[model samples]
Target: MDFQESKTKENLARSFAAECQEGARYQFMAKMAQQQGYQYMSMLIRTLAHNEMAHAQQFFNKIVELGGNQTQNIEITAGYPFKSGELLDVLKQEAENEHMSAESIYPKFADIARDEGFEDVANLFDMVSKVERTHERTLKKLHENLSCNCLYKCNDEHAFKCDECGTIIMNKCAPKTCPLCKMGQGYYRIDFSIN
Candidate 1:
């Protein structure tokens, strides 16, 4: 199938639409985190939002490379308004979203791209699907820890820095939030690594 053909074009446009939706979703989550006093978490989520934007740009660039149409792009529909709830509720929702993307959405897109001979796009889909799966696992772990009330049970010495107020705290785990700035524990960092 040619890149500009209907099936290929629809997939590219839909992929771009999905990327845009994911980007917006992350941004909304980041905003919510920031409002809830999770500064570091907000920052990390914002970084993720930026990454999603980059992915959308890549999809868009590919569509443009194949001479995408504005009308067709506008016609492409994608997005899901996430549910708002308590902390555990939010975590569960995110985990479910990640699972859907990893197990259903991306894999299907990857397969279609492969069949259409768009190896590069297929690779992108596969890579993103793997990342989504990892995210699902991490979210589930967080949910489990919170559910069991063991989020801050540690014997060895541990420390965390508040991303909002820059307060240094030494404890078994991060405080429920920064005592000084009231930033959520999500804003607390135990060990930040750079690659």
Candidate 2:
């Protein structure tokens, strides 16, 4: 069977396009966060953007492997989200989109790949879906914390570290601004790495 005629090939192309758009969207959100003085938050979003681009690269590699390196203008039509707003709204939109991708879109794509005898493609979709789930959870957690104004809070006395000046303070929540650097609360790292 010709790979070019397979659904998985089209799926790969679609995935690549979608991931590229997602990466760009995340990058824009990160830029907005940075402009609003959310240093640590911007960093986290940028990391997600990079991850999305890496996913795009993986899909592109697969496409190249199947169709050769030359430009193969495989015409494809797919619906994509255009959600943009304030930082909080953007975060929420990303979380919702990631959830949809992980729970609905990718699963169906994976099933199609499997049914079409493209086990490797199915595994790729599954793996990406798992990462998307993680992204959804992480972004949702961050969104909730930010919305509640407790991103830097803890139940017990915990050390809040400043990303700019490396200042550390033990308290239930971070200070309004870093004492050393005079940076705003956003400069305090939230350690979203664990989320």
Candidate 3:
């Protein structure tokens, strides 16, 4: 495949994976909410899962509609990368991934639509892009206030130590700031777990 073809395939794969992951996460949330006696949240999660499934199907249809093969296989990893135990975290990750995918994929689709003389389709993609941008902003707000225990426990004390202040903060704090120097976290080099 050429560069454009490769990029298209990657974007398609990432979008497909994001949709599947969001669907599964919503389903999981629904089940967990039910068990936790949160009936309203459970129903909402179920509804969201339905929406994600529709989105996934729509994306598949669009690929075929645009003269792309429908049988292309995509591999979905096992678990979500973000903190999935918290509802807000789940929503934030979903929205962020959707926005990222929209930013990367929708433009390509729009370009294709324009090349094919489908001005209406291009306009639709533009609208989708705007929606995704809104979603990204909303999720960022949610992520800022939400907190949860680290999904993966790290045993290496050196990993949590801030390079500037040399303070050994916990995993959660390791991503935020150095308690001593107040330097921005994620600045120190530390191996992140791949969920």
Candidate 4:
């Protein structure tokens, strides 16, 4: 089968567009978080946005390298979420979106690529699916923490790091503001390592 005419090629194009859209959406979410006085949360969302962009880059590279699609339009039709609401609700919905991509969307793409004899593209989809799973977990945990008003709280003695000034504080809950940077508690982050 010709690589340029394969379904895998189409999937790659779709994946690239989807990842780009997700990155932009997350940036919008980050801006909202920052405006709402959750600086560290905004930074975290920006990190996710960056990850999505990286995924987009990989997909674009695949289209160029395997499909020679640099000048040609790939002509893909796909649906994307347009969400707005409270920041917490948005995060929760984003988590669900990640779950759909990880468990349903990307896996199906990978299977199709494998059946089409595009093993490398299948592997790429598999790898990105795993990352999306992690993204889902991270977003869900974030939604839970923020909803419970424990974005920086723990039941046991723990450490919190200020996103600014690199200040480390050991406490059950973050201070109202960083002692050094004077930034609000929103600048503090607790390890959510959803791995």
Candidate 5:
């Protein structure tokens, strides 16, 4: 489908820029998480960054296939409430971004793509929207737990994956260090879904 002269092309271009920026943002967040000793969180965030890059690549390919070119420069401007120095504030802002993307932006883009007969793009948008929702939920929980000082003492035994050695462990609290890799508690990914 040659969507070069269509609104969908413009939308795709914009989405591509957003995805690229998101990838960079996630990478920055991942670095901050690692600096804060949240190794598992850092790993997860880096994975997300990679996913975002994949999304951007897909969008770029689709745009090119539709005969769109980057001969003309695009000026992108964006602003969010997150500051790099504050972890809690950044988490809240990221959650808010995910909520907006899942609830509004991605849904609208998916609808447009569907209407334009771009089923593949629509499906990708829908999948990304779902993932954004999950990210939003997780970030909210993390923010809440950190605020309440209950991240390590929630009395909830849930499965955790060691980010260092990929060992799965079921524990109510994060271990001081992974037995397999000798990594700290921050290297474990704990599930917060259980009450």
Candidate 6:
């Protein structure tokens, strides 16, 4: 195939990968929210999942329009090391993944766009990178708020278990550390038992 065709394929692959990553993240978030009884969070995650799916479809259409076949697939691998099954952990993971994808994949697509004289495509990639960056910042803020231990001090026997990080907190002594994942204590949630 020609250089343009090759470049288009590469862009499609990158976009597919990014969509897959976002989909996995949203799934995880929804699951965690359900476990934690966070109705809003769960709804938000489901919405995000739909949005990512739409983006993936858009990329697929673009690839087909460019006379390319769907050549890449998505695989949901193991979760991140710092992810403790907590909302904060989920947000952190999402932010980190978006940042990493922007840094690694976007530039390659940008290069390809430049080489193939597809400056508009390159600009689109740049716009995507910027949006991903914004998402990272928002997630970071949410993580900080959830993980903060400044105003909570409870010594109750029932430590609320954070559905996201699975950390057990006692008497507000929620260690800023997740024993399971070695993540900071900010990722822990109260462990509540139905009994």
Top candidate when judged by lDDT against the true structure: 4
TM-score of each: 0.75, 0.90, 0.48, 0.93, 0.79, 0.60
Candidate 2 accuracy as TM-score = 0.90
Question: How far does residue 92 in candidate 1 sit from its true spot (Å)?
Answer: 1.6
lDDT of 3 by residue, 52-71 (tens): 67666755565566535544
Point out the worst 10-residue segment of candidate 1 by lDDT.
68-77
Superposition error at 144 for model 4 (Å): 0.2
lDDT of 6: 0.61
Q: Which stretches of candidate 3 lie over 4 Å from their true place?
A: 1-6, 68-82, 95-195
Q: Cα miss at 171, model 2 (Å)? A: 0.6
- The number of clashing residue pairs in each candidate reads 1, 0, 0, 0, 0, 17
TM-score of structure candidate 6: 0.60
lDDT of 2 by residue, 36-146 (tens): 878888888999999999999989988888778654788898999996788899899999999998999899999998898888888999999999999998799879888
Q: Which of the two candidates, 3 or 5, achieves a greater lDDT against the reference?
A: 5
Candidates sorted on lDDT, descending: 4, 2, 5, 1, 6, 3
For each of the candidates, the C-alpha root-mean-square deviation to the true structure, in angstroms, is 3.8, 2.4, 14.5, 2.3, 3.5, 10.7
Clashes of 3: 0
- What shift in Å separates residue 96 of candidate 6 from its native position after superposition? 0.7
Which candidate number maximizes TM-score?
Answer: 4
Supply the TM-score for candidate 3: 0.48
Query: How would you encode candidate 4's per-residue C-alpha lDDT over 147-186 as one tens digit per residue?
Result: 8988888887678888888888888888998999899988
Tens digit of lDDT per residue, candidate 1, span 18-122?
A: 667777876777787678665655676577667667777877787777664543533556666558777678778878987998899889988888888888888
Error of 2 at 187 (Å): 1.7
